[model samples]
Target chain A: MAALNYIRSNEKKLKVIKSNSITFDNDTKPMAQHQLQPENWVDLYADYLFNYAIGRISDSEVAKDLVQETFMAGLKSAKNYKGDAAERTWLIAILKRKVIDYYRKINSNKGKAEVRMNYSAQSDAEGDWLEEQVADPFSSFENSNIENEELGLAIQDCISKLPKKQALVFTMKTIQGISTEDICNELDINPSNLWVMIHRARTALMDCLNQNWF
Target chain B: MISCEKAAIICNKAQYREATFIEKLKLRFHLLMCKTCSKATKKNTQLTSLCDKANLHSLTENDKLKMKEILQEKD
Candidate 1:
């Protein structure tokens, strides 16, 4: 049936909704999450926006707010959504904006000194030995088999603990899903230097995750 | 003339997928004969995805309510 086709194709969002536990903020209730129509905003996009926030802020509390803010905004703008993308994707886009806005606002209000590193993908392999830079040998791994703790969190911790430059490069490449060239431009590092830093970041993260995640 | 050490550097960026094509071919050719670099590449990658696979945190009920309140504040 058409419904079955939709369900199977949209399984990722469906899985999120089915597994989601909806929550609301206490500040000014959008009063929209409480809307009792068949569509529960929280269940539908909770994990997506929540994950988006966590990825951006890396702080649990702030990430939580970002999700809530996203939902509130989505609720108001739901009519404009138009089902062009998955609900989760739409909500995530909104959350990304909120995160950027948070940084912009905080920067102005605090007026504190901060080193703003612009990440860029303007890079190319230095030369030969690119095989080392090719596919990650372990890309085919089944991480689901090892279940000590969330490897992602453990890795993020290790990444955060890395040298500032290494961490920034690693974060941009992995988390922001940006390119190395862009990261180099953002950090103003040469390709060779970028490779070295990335190596350090990887080694540290690999060790951290291997020891801790398992 | 990628020495084993330089090979290691290239191998490192490869894990991050920052390597170029010919560099990969060179590294691969070396890896075909160099056991040490091959093992290093394997171990390095095993570690990278382990961390990359880590899931981002999710929101809770209290924060959702707070967000609602924030939005409604202006309304």
Candidate 2:
């Protein structure tokens, strides 16, 4: 009788799995593509986009403004979204343009041109060609900055590849440094479950970084 | 005498500084006997340092809320 009951439960579980796969298959169909949830944009992509911006620009206030502008542009261009790329990817493409616009605005500003001319003039009485040709002593610092940005992008890419729950937990615990208890409360998970998720995330991240980074 | 699985759990906990004193001692003993786990621990430490070096920053809560407000207003 116990063995019969076990078989019944196994059948029930299989039915659930089969039905879930059916929905998953349907979701993957070309006609039924992924939908955007604009309301959840801030909760989902804000931090990731902010980090991407700040790493490139290294200015907190401008990064925040650019993130806001990206969302605004995303909303305006919602109809053009093909749903072929993931929502975050689409948003990132917008943010990239926003960042470029920011750089162009600053570079083309009248005040910035005056500042640049003043800097070159202060370097030497003669033409600034020699000053421009000489290698910067602090070039190593710039190189390290580029290296850190690349490393940061690699890590973010790996985190994005994780399951959504695992990514959220890992980011909260490791990157954001939120208290474990707080994460548990927010995610409605127990400590042990959190640890298991963390373990899985760390192991997967290590393997990914080994392949792509190390 | 702890299993490798147990040692790995302890090692992860140690990374967060959440392992108890006894758990850490047991992990140390396990690492001493287990070459594979010791190598893994080293890689895990390297991962931690790399994360630190990356210095990735996130948006503050208020900033995120402001962004949401802007989106809502436009929408």
> DockQ, per-model, please?
0.24, 0.58
lDDT of 2 by residue, A40-66 (tens): 888778877888999779889999899
User: Which one wins on lDDT?
Assistant: 2
In the order shown, what is each candidate's alpha-carbon RMSD?
A: 19.0, 13.2
The segments of candidate 2 whose C-alpha lies over 4 angstroms from its true place after superposition are A1-45, A80-90, A103-109, A116-133, A136-140, B60-75
The regions of model 1 sitting more than 4 angstroms off are A1-149, B55-75
Q: What are the clashing pairs of model 2?
A: none
lDDT, candidate 1, B1-75, per-residue tens? 578878888887677676789889889999988898898889887765654556534343355455556655634
lDDT of 1 at B9: 87
Interface root-mean-square deviation, candidate 2: 1.9
Model 1 CAPRI rating: acceptable
lDDT of 2 at A169: 86
